[model samples]
Target: MPNLPLTLGCWDYDRVQALMDGRVRPEGIDLTFLNMVVEETFFRMLRNREFDVSEMSMSSYLVSLTKPDRPFVAIPVFPSRFFRHSCIYVNADAGIDSPADLVGKRFGCPEYQMTAPVWIRGILSDHYGVPVDGPTYVTGGEEEPNRQEKVPLDLPPNFRVERIGPTDTLAQMLADGRIDAFHTARKPSTYDGVRVKRLFPDYVEVEKAYWRDTGIFPIMHVVAIRREVYEANRWIAMNLFQAFREAQRLTYEGLKETAALKGMLPWFNAHVEETFDTMGDDFWPYGVEPNRATLDTFLRYHHEQGLSPHKLSVDDMFAPETLEEFVI
Candidate 1:
């Protein structure tokens, strides 16, 4: 008989397609997959512990560690990794031509403690000497009028974060020049106009330089198991970890299969080759040891940005079962 059944919540990204289709399955366990938008999934999972397993925001997960009754433990399976250089947008007329100019400026954010913004701000401060608290941050939805921070923050006195009313939004304020810039995980709908432009005109080049220097790809989301579920079934950690790795392996194979262009791009194959050359063969590695630098870097940023009440190490983040993988 099967050991038990579990519900797993995540986006239907290409990386997890095999698992979603039942082509890959964890040993001794059955999974009920919940395909949902990342925003809704994260909100529900973090706020209510609504799923047995789910993908969670790295920033929010760190903050959750501060609570006396932590509800979840994460595996090192990153479902989403993105560089945030392209997330920062500035008003064309704001005189913010470079990262250094962002100091003392007014910036809008959907949430100051979101993973993308945390990585962007940390990079800005560490790489360009911009103070992490340099800008006065206004928080609200990117397009909609009503939004709020998912969790409370414990910031230093110099850090200024103001929550906006239901009638206000970051995109509208940015277009109207009420804010000098806005940073978000997704592009604002107002981005089609001339009023707002990406802070880095050549963001690709900028991002490449950053990666070359730091070797950090910046993990946005990680897979987590409900604490009670994990405690009741400790062996499930490795089973789920191996299943995710197999799913990712299938994704890599699909990307390289050149019988026809797997994606819509004309240069899909060439792009894959170039990426391998630039980022190395195992670009999207999943294990804890392979991702230690990135995990450590993000943890440091979370602590320094006051998102985490105290500094937490990488070991504090992942399950002990996930800390090592068996070698052949």
Candidate 2:
């Protein structure tokens, strides 16, 4: 049989650019790449199984594991990783000087179960002594209206979450004093002025310290294949995983070739060198073993926050083929 053609959905990130441009081809597969906004890709995949393979929110993926019928299975190819400390924005007039000050305040999130907010919530509770249930949570769209949670959540009674009406975005709520702070993966539109500022002004320093302490560069998304597809073509998982790793390798090489600086930043090379110094040679790693710490912490957060019905081990998230590779 010929290599099966598959639709792969993801954001147009540099790491996945090579795959989309046909520079990196998965063995025994004809991939048709669909580059779109991450939210669109995730929503479509989860709600409708819109693609043969797609990028999915890690938190959402964990929660899906608890369901009776999960439509997708993931590989360890993490397309998006970020530090959530900088995702938090607080109103200047809210008297929130630190994560500790967030207690007893009203805070907004794009979604409570979204990957970024889950990481932010975990950081606040673990590092800064801010309890997850301490603040009232307002859930709504960050920039647009009429956004809804991708999965159904059975939050505990102690957790307080209020869904906003269609007229309001979380950004407007934070700026108008309806909420004291907001957390969104993307900067809220209201942050264009002084109305909103990050709770941690020196987030870069704080995030670096956090990484040094925890060795977790919070994973936001994992690449998943439709369950039906994976059942029929199990080898495709390893093939895709290897192809993604190759693409990531290309991205890292691009970051180091500053002789003719590919990006516009003047201090790009200095930053790249510092990143390798701080994060080690493999800055954005792809395999399951290398990212076990981050995976464990994220799963714990998901279960504790009522996003997942049970605590999921790292082994439950990926294909059996991904757990081992043939040595050449």
Runs of candidate 1 with Cα error greater than 4 angstroms are none
List model 2 lDDT by residue over 183-290, tens digit each: 888998888547888888888999999999999999999999999999998999999999999998999989989679867788888998999999999978898999
Models 1 onward score TM values of: 0.98, 0.98
Measured by C-alpha RMSD in angstroms, how accurate is candidate 2?
1.1
State, as a TM-score between 0 and 1, how close model 1 is to the true structure: 0.98
Residue pairs with colliding backbones in model 2 are: none
The residue pairs in collision within model 1 are: none
Candidate 1's C-alpha lDDT?
A: 0.90
lDDT of candidates 1 onward, in order: 0.90, 0.90
